[model samples]
Target: MNCYTLIKQKILAVITQLQSNGGLPADLKVDAITVEPPKSRDHGEMSTNVAMVLAKAVGQPPRVLAELFLTHIQEFDEVRTADIAGAGFINMRLHPSFWYAHLSTILKEKEAYGSSDIGQGHAMNVEYVSVNPTGPMHAGHGRVAIVGDAMAALMEKGGYDVTREYYINDGGAQAETLARSAYLRYLEALGQDIGEIPSGLYPGDYLKAVGESIAKNYGDAFKDQTEEEYLPFFETYAIDAMMDLIRDDLDLIGIQHDVFTSETAIVNEGAVEDVMDMLEEKGLIYTGVLDVPKGIEVDDWAAEPQLLFRSTQFGDDVDRVLKRTNGEWTYFAKDIAYHFDKFERGFDYQINVWGADHAGYIKRMLAAVKALSDDTVTLDIKTCQMVNLMQGGEPLKMSKRSGTFVTLRDVVEAVGKDVIRFVMLMRRNDAMLDFDFDKVKEQSKDNPVFYVQYAHARVYSVLRQAEAQIGQIDEVQLQNADFTCLNSDDEIGLIQVLASWPRCIEGAVIHREPHRIGGYLYELAGAFHALWNQGKEDTTLRFIVDDTKVTLARLALLKAVATIIASGLNLFGVEPLKEMR
Candidate 1:
């Protein structure tokens, strides 16, 4: 059970009893009531502002209402003490029995301990890592791939029916450039002199393989053809090759999207025109002239009436252009149709993961979703900052245009996929991350992934020894262990942190921050390690003691710890360790 949720329910029950006795108005709304941990642990384990939230409605002073809650809350079996803090805040320190019970629940529920039934299978669509099919993926793409996949996994734990999507960006100018680059390599494959890769085209050495494959199939057919005659076939051939390489890169990180939507397919199906006509019918589309963006010079300006969307009415800085002066639909127009199609497929919520460079694009895209879905769907954009590769305490040089950037394959080969995925989530998506090669491999507490895995391994080691030293300690015996033996400070403190896992899941899902899970796991591991070291320092405090009852109690506690660590790692798509290497 979630500790905070339990506290909230207890407070609600007290309020209900008060209402029944006419101490509170029966019709008063208590939706604003909150019960969470205090900012400072010194205040109490959990705090609430129910009195302050209902003071005005109940026509009483907040302190007076706080007094009433204080009396009723003190009588709760879970609460050891309930006090009125500043501004009618209720701070509570729960009894040790409460934590012991929660620990028992952890052992009984196993992987289902932290999961909540709040979602009820709501549909969610998460789109990320939609890299263009012009070349192989670079190290920078790894961040989005991990973030999106982990986020989807996190939602699945909360019971959301999620779809992982990849939108192929093939219908763009870069696809043509890819065709041209591959054609040059194809000429070289056909024994023709095609020296010096051209400017404004891909210069990656990977394209040579695509050209050789084409030469083996079509032979000399495209070598003698004009750009117009060979461009289409070359585009299709190169994009297919690049997509294969991209899939290989994603496979290195264990990412497989449920759907791969093609921009070309969306355009070919007339979805864009249909969306535009609908928008026009809603009076959201109009032909208008826009001012030159502030940085552009007047000499280079082209001012004319263009088909625009009324994005400004929905909180965009300015109206967005739907069609260019030459009657070509802009990328924004196609995106609008894409989101509309997603909404029509019956997803209740949609999340788009974008790079830091797309920060300014969020407002207009959200405005489009609002206009098109009539505010029936929720669209959230998660902006992820860049990942800087570091080794020997210096930056790793990488550039796509120069074709010297580190490919995802290179990094995956260097440090296993688990390390890459773990390191990617060490920082918040909006914060710049530096992935130091030396630091991640260190087998110390300084490395978070190692520390967590080691804790699990440590627990596993003890559990196996306990089986030999004691007897078969199955789930039934664990559930019936003497929890009252667990009353020491460090023992109870460890249980307190274990109780916070459900709260952690709730907060992570609400804030859309999977990095919180990384932090939570690190904290949980630290707690387990601290208790283990305490046993080493003090003989009486050891987990495996001579007294059979106490030893069983401690082993059950370790089992709970291992279960939670496994649950969290499972959600991250990483295997829980039985031994550290």
Candidate 2:
């Protein structure tokens, strides 16, 4: 079904025939040969570098080898012509029938047209949105959430067994701080005149409900308990409430993790101790006084002897501390155990989506995975940069409700879930994104989400109009259309874009970049829009011509465009609009 792959196979067959006929060396390496689209449409539809790559090996000039290969390849019925370009690159033009048949394949496959079996069922664990369960998720968390979700969906489409996961940082000093903050609110709920929240405690109003809930359930039972007695209960209750808030924010953007792994649970199960023991056995763990990190002033830092991981052995700049001088395990220690647990669960690959602030942690984390898994598992870490929220070219301030930052819910509620998801993915994860409220909501071609959705809506409108003017044209009728009537350049150009969907999916999956799908969808939409506009000047170019055969063929083309759009949108978790209202 992949036209490019089909063409490449024919080119390879011709090269093999040439080798048999002594036109080229039988021992020449053909693995490096590649078939791709020509740089300019004027050159040809497809181009290959087989001749150029094999020329030096075969003891012949590139042009001479290219001519021989072209002579043999031109024998194929699908390739209308093959010509040698500069330096012996072979440019080819295929028969229009070759492109037109892809429309039938798209119509039959529908949303499944671009799906492939590249992963071969390898288990991939994608951990993202592991924001501390201390408060509502912010805009940065939203970006990672969508990116991770889309990546998981893309991997699944490419045949990877994907597991969406969230790692809760509920066993740290931050969790204790959250507990103390909730306890203050709990005192307030009991009618205690506790003045403004203490300097070190959380001051957000969102915790008031958690305080009230505990006051109602336990009554005066915990009113006079010591810090040691009440800290555990408050910490557990606060984490649950905060996690619920985080989940609600994710729900607004259609994200739900398959597993929520708790740091506290892993620590309580002695997993951290076990990992430390394993690393120690392998000589990766040691008692050491680490050098001061670069960029840190000596006067502002103090070095303490502690248990450290030999992260430098795996490309990190320095060894990392696994336990503090006070003997408590560091966050990195628990993370090492968590990743080891994932490997123990039998995942072949692991991916972590982190914020740009955590870029320095990548090497150490990868080192941990390598050491713990004995190089049996591969880990890929993606870092999402900051999102700058703007309106009318001015940066918007923090939300008054959240106090500290713009909550994910605020963005989703303001511009809607579909716009939020689309705009977030409009750029790659490593690039900074500007989310303009006015511009993204604008109903024009400048807005990518609207432009793509409008294309899909236009297809539905055309179908409705076609049915009303030429009797009902269902799937059967469209499939029976005389597709050979689609002979114009515009018609063939659209099919070419549609035919690249599978290739696009494979590329996106391999690169672990879902933003490519957004780019492809935009290009596909532009191509369809251009063809639709062509009808305005030429009456013959109109989709609904008087000829039933021509109209049916055009309808089939429209359906194929709509189907591919829907398929791409599904990977992004964005809904395809049937109508633009």
Candidate 3:
């Protein structure tokens, strides 16, 4: 069991004992009590501050209550000791055998070792990388895609039903720009010899392929058609082509969305007007003038009255526009409809992953979803910070208009999807990521992904070598082996790190952050490397000792490390390498 599980039992036992002794009030709530690891590892393997939090309610000194609870926790065999530390914190150091036993559990459960039921099978919808379907995905888009995918994977392991979604910006000014770019390319393909791309039109050569494909399919059929007639066809063709390119880019980076929701489809299905009507009926919609946004006021801000939603009443900074005076629905209107549709589809929670550039929009979007759903919906918007690409200690610049950007495909093709996925997930999503192309591809300990994967691969190498030299190893043989032979400090230390795997999963799932998994994997790898180095320094520390029984037991411990690394890698859809090549 994980430390959390064991400590939870201890906390519950102590709370029950206190209740029986009339130390706690009758009908006291115990739901808020939690037992987790302390911030400092030296303090304890597990920690609980429940006594401190409950002291005021129970009218008792925290240290006195902690001492009372310690007696009950100390009875458990797993808890070597329970003592009150500074500020009345209960620090519980688990028995050494308690930690060592997790190695056996890891081997027993294999890849399913750390799975938990925290989610209770709740449904969660995560939408990310909803970039406009007018061009290839850039590095920023890649970050969101990878983050969202990894989050979903982690949630699945934590027992949640998750739908990975992409909201296609297919009906907007951007789509029109893409259509115009394709038209220009089409003209050039027809021997018109268009000069430099104008400032408003896309300049990337990505559309050249789209233009050629259209020419091959339609030939001269579009030559005589009016702008109105051919524009729709070109827009559809170009958007489809762009989506195909985007899908390929995602495939290269190991991201596949379960749902692709199109904003254009919302309008096509008349859901936008339906949602507006629903909100109007709720008295949440009204026609009013908007105060000009501070620091970036539009010249037309005070020119006329615009249709507005009372977002400010629901915690937004200002009332947002539903439609412009030009009789077109605002982007916010379509987004409101999209989210309402998602709510209607029965997702309990929806998470939107956006680039840091959209930080200002979070309040309004959250406000819109709140107001539209009458506060029955939970909309979480995660803003991912920027990524600065570097190669050989220098900046790597990417510009779509300048045709100098590196596509996701380029990075994936260069480093392979597994390395790309692992490296991308090695940092917090909100923190700015420094992607060093050279370091990521390096086959050395400097690359965190390589280091973790090598640990797993090295374990496998040792296991395969044992099997070749001593025949197949099994659980009974390992359990019956001199597990006490694993008495070395390095071996015991490795087992302790493996014992934290289930705790790491719980933390990652609780915070909805997958970077914690990467951190745990790195530590586990460090433990494995330490054990391997110890083997180099002392022959008896190696996986294959002279006695076959002891060797098999050590092999079992190595298998536990491989099992955890594989599970962690699977949680991120990262392929654990067989060897560091």
Candidate 4:
């Protein structure tokens, strides 16, 4: 069992013993008492605040309660010592065997070492990179793609049935613009001299390639037809081409979505009207006018009434428009229809991963979900802040409309996928990340991706050297090896880290944050590196030593640490290096 589980059980037993001894009530709930590693290593292996939480209710001083609980907790095989620290914190030190026994569990579980059932098969749908289909994906899109993919992996490891989804915005005025742009490309592909692209239209070379493909397919047959005849064909062709390019880009970064729900499909299949009828029946949507948005002024803002959704009832800043005065449906209406479709499809929870610029849109979108489903469905929108790219301490500029954007493919090509995935997860999703191209690509220890990978590689190196020295060291033999030989401070620190993996996973999964995994891996690497450096100072500290049982015991500890590194790297979608050059 992991250290956290072991400590929790001991704490419960102590509580029961206290109640039985007439020091507390028989039915006191001990679920809130928790055991965690102390803030500093000097305190103890684990600490609990059970006394502080139960002090007032039990009618005793916290320190008195802690001393009373300590007498009973000291009998457990896991805890070697239990002492009351300042203000009622009880610090507990586990016997060396407590950590030594975990080696067998790690070797047996292997890849499943850190997996947890915290989610208990909860269903979650994560939608990300729902970028407009008008242009190629820029650098910011790359950060969101990496962050979303890693988050899904982490959630799945926590036992959630996660669905990765992409909402394709292939409708509205943007669609018309794409069609017009493609039609212009079609004319140019036919060898006609078309002038420079107009100011408001897309001006990328990707469109030129789409134009060439259309020229080869239809030739000059549609040259005489008006836009009314060619617009539909162009729309279908352009959307398909744009999706193809996006798929290629996602593939480069190892991002794969299970569903590609198109907004146009909702309108084509009459789902939009069906959803609106449902809202009308509930009296949630009505005809009204939206006040001008805060902090901005528009000259042509209409004062006319329009169709609006009563989102303010559900905590939105204001009611949102569902239709303009011209009788055309607004983007918000189609988005509401899309979420209604998700709920109808039986998703227990919906997670939308949006860019930081979309923060203002989250409140109303959540309000719409609440109004439509009576709060049965939960919508959680995580907005990732900007990723500022720097190379050798210089900023990298990117502009999608100006055709100066750097595609996701360029990043993965420059730095491998493993580096990109791990670095993106080194900070919380909401925090701005400065991705220094120079630092991430470095081979030094400061690059966390390489540092963690290198620790695993070092363990493999020792294993290979051990094999050459002792022919073979099978796990069955290692299990029976005398673990009492593990005595060095570095060896003990490594054991402590391995025992904390399950707790780390539990915390990261609870907060829906994956950056904790990155921080934990870095600490694990530090432990492994410390042990390796110790080996340099004392040659006898090396993993293999003439088939000695102590040496075998050290190898066992090494294997446990490496197993955790591999498990954590998998959650972050980073490959564990078997050997570093």
The best candidate by lDDT is 2
- Candidate 4 displacement at residue 440 in angstroms: 1.4
lDDT of each residue in 131-198, candidate 3, tens digit only? 88978888778888888889888888888888999999999789989998998888778777789989
What's the ranking of the predictions by lDDT, best on top? 2, 1, 4, 3
Q: Model 3 compared with the native: what TM-score?
A: 0.95
Model 2, residue 333: distance off in Å is 1.2
TM-score against truth, every candidate: 0.96, 0.96, 0.95, 0.94
Pairs that collide in candidate 2 are none
Error of 3 at 380 (Å): 2.0
**Local error of candidate 1 at residue 500 (angstroms):** 1.4
Candidate 4 lDDT, 1-581, residue by residue in tens: 55787778867876787689886888776667888999987898899888998888898999998887788778777788888899999898888888877766787788797788887888888889888887677768988888888778888888889999999999988887888888888899998887988877777778887888998988987777898898888888899999988888888778889999999998788887888898899998887767777766677676788788888999998988888767878888899999998988878687888899999999999998998889999788888998888889899766453376776666777888888888888998899998889999787789998889999999989888888887788878767777778876667777888878888888887787889999999999998898888768888877877647877888888888888998988887777888887
Separate clash counts for every candidate: 0, 0, 0, 0
Residue 32's lDDT within candidate 3 is 75
lDDT of each: 0.89, 0.91, 0.83, 0.84
lDDT of 3 at 304: 74
Model 2 per-residue lDDT tens digits across residues 493-535: 8889999999889889889999999999999999999999999
- Estimate, for each residue in 14-73, the C-alpha lDDT of model 1 and write its tens digit: 889889999999888889899987987789888999999999999999999999999988
